[model samples]
Target chain A: MQTIGKLSAATGVKVPTIRYYEQVGLLPQPARTQGNQRLYDRRAVQRLSFIRHARDLGFPLDAVRELLGLADDPDRSCAAADAIARRQLHEVNARIQRLNALRDELERMLRHCACGTISECRVIEVLGSHAHCQGGHIEGADLAGD
Target chain B: MQTIGKLSAATGVKVPTIRYYEQVGLLPQPARTQGNQRLYDRRAVQRLSFIRHARDLGFPLDAVRELLGLADDPDRSCAAADAIARRQLHEVNARIQRLNALRDELERMLRHCACGTISECRVIEVLGSHAHCQGGHIEGADLAGD
Candidate 1:
């Protein structure tokens, strides 16, 4: 058995995030010692590692839950897992496309910038007036949040 | 002068988000009617629209704030705004590159799946075991959060 810190060290997942995973039902309730310290077995180690890897690959928490469910049952068909991965792939592609459009718009704004005053600044102008935009890039997508 | 709802309709910014902008100091505190209703004028409409457009283009709140500051002062050099745009472009590029790598990895996983059972599933296997990864894709970047 390993302590929560040891488990975090082993899996490279942060302590609070590990707790969050548990809270979100991604990680099962770990065994606790007599002093109330969290204890994890080898299974916890492997599960956390799987979650970390899947998260690094950009899978959402819900999708990771689905994947864990599939992993727990070895007899289930792998089609569900494949579908999840495919769905993630589609999302990644869509984000890439949207980001590319934003990049292009930024580039255009920078390219046209006269380096004068804010009143004449292409960057500010483009952002201040949507009519200055060349593309329909205003989808109201919060890039940082996403 | 218009009501908060009118401002929302004019700028296409949600009412709650406008309040959030006000709370964040992006939008100035508006005039209040005797009935305690928020009232906005033409400047609020323009400022909210500017914020909405900046947000839709994927500018983070801080960057939006900087841009708004520059817009408020018409005589400031546009270099600051240009720099911000350039920085955002760089971020968008980096994200696109990371997502492309993820896309490639996802595609590889799906391509190798044998359509068999979970015990032999390549998708689960790759996720469960990092050694199956061909690239250094585990940068610990939280894709969804980013």
Candidate 2:
């Protein structure tokens, strides 16, 4: 058995986050010692490593939860896992496209700035005029959700 | 003078978000009528529109605040604005690079899955082995901050 700190070292997830995962049901509650400290078995280490890997790859928590459920049942088909990965890939691609568009606009603004006073600053001019923008508002709130 | 609802209509920013901008000091507290309703001038309309446009382009609130400050001082040099845009572009480029790497790994995993059982699943195998990843851990927490 390992303490929470040991588990964090083993999995590279912080101790508080490990407890949070348990609270959120992403991780199974572990057995406790007589002093009421969390004690995790080898299985907990493997499970947490999996969660960390998935999160590092930018899978949303819901997708991570689904992936974990699929992972737990060894006899299950891998179709669900494939689908989740594909959906994540699609979202990543969409974000990339949006970011590229934003980069283009920013680049244009910077290039046209002329390093002049703010009144003549093309950056401010472009930002102040909707006509100069390419279509589609990339909502800040949508980025927040991701 | 325009009502908050009219400002929302004019700028494509919602009523609550305009109020939020006010609360956050992004938008100035406008004058009020005898009925205590907010009253905005043409200048407010332009400023709110600028904020909305900058936000739609994925400028973080701090960068947006700086850009607004630079805009407010018409005689100030535009170097700060240029720097902010350049920094934002660099961030966007980094995100694109990371997402591309993630896409490559996810694509490879999906291709190699073979529709097999979970135990034989390439998706699980790839996730379980850090060697299978390209490089660097992109924490979901970092994405939240952006």
Candidate 3:
């Protein structure tokens, strides 16, 4: 068993993030030490490792939670897991497309810039006037956020 | 002049987001009708469009503010706007690189799965073992808070 801070060091996960995982129930409630500090066992280590890997790969917390559920049900078909992965792939592909469009727009805006004043700034001009917009940019944080 | 809701509809921006822009001082405080409803001018429309377009190109709100300030300043050199664009381009490139890394990792993890139970699930196993990870696959929204 190790203290939460020690576990955080070993896992390379931030202390607050670990606490967040615990708050979200992704990590089981760890036992407390005599001094009231959180103590983690090997299982906690494993869970943190899983969370870290998932996060590193860009799985949102909610998706990670669903993945953990699917992972816990060993007897379940791999179809669900496969589905989740495919969904993530789709999302990633869409983002790449969007970002590519943005890259092009930024490029064009930058390329034509005369470097005079904002009135002569191509970047600001494109953004300020949608008259020439080709319908590719929508910059909300998440398309699927509820 | 359009009300906030109408402006939201016209721009495809959300109601709360419009209010958020107002709160953050991106949009000037609008005139109020006797009913206290916000009223916007064509200039406000232009400003919001500029803000939204900059945002879609992945410019941070702070960067957007700088660009807006540049637009407002007729005497300021367009170099400031160009600088902001260049900065955003760099950010976009960095994000693309990170997403590519994440995608590679996700692909590897998915490829390694043996279609077994959760006890032997390669997806879970991959996530639970950090040593095997190279990293990719994060949502853009999560990328922002970091």
* Candidate with the greatest lDDT versus the true structure: 1
lDDT per residue as tens, model 3, A8-49? 888888899899888989998899978888999998887787
Instruction: Give me the TM-scores for chain A across all models, comma-separated.
Output: 0.93, 0.92, 0.89
Candidate 1: tens digits of C-alpha lDDT, residues B28-52: 8999999999999888888898998
Candidate 1's C-alpha runs over 4 A off are A142-146, B142-146
Q: What would the per-residue lDDT of candidate 2 be over residues A1-146, giving only the tens digit for each residue?
A: 99999999988899999999999999998999999999999999988988988887888888999998988888999988889999998987787777777878888778877998889999888888888766644654355434
> Which ranges of candidate 3 are over 4 A from the true structure?
A134-146, B134-142
DockQ of each: 0.73, 0.64, 0.54
Which of the two, 1 or 2, has more lDDT?
Answer: 1
Show how many residue pairs clash in every candidate, following the order shown: 0, 0, 6
TM-scores for all candidates? 0.94, 0.93, 0.89
CA RMSD of each candidate after superposition: 1.8, 2.0, 3.0
Score candidate 3 by TM-score against the native. 0.89
1 or 2, greater by DockQ? 1
Q: Write the per-residue lDDT of candidate 3 for residues B56-102, one digit (tens) a residue.
A: 77777899899888888877788988988998877676666666666
lDDT of 2 at B137: 45
How should the candidates be ordered by DockQ, best one leading?
1, 2, 3
lDDT of 2 at A16: 98
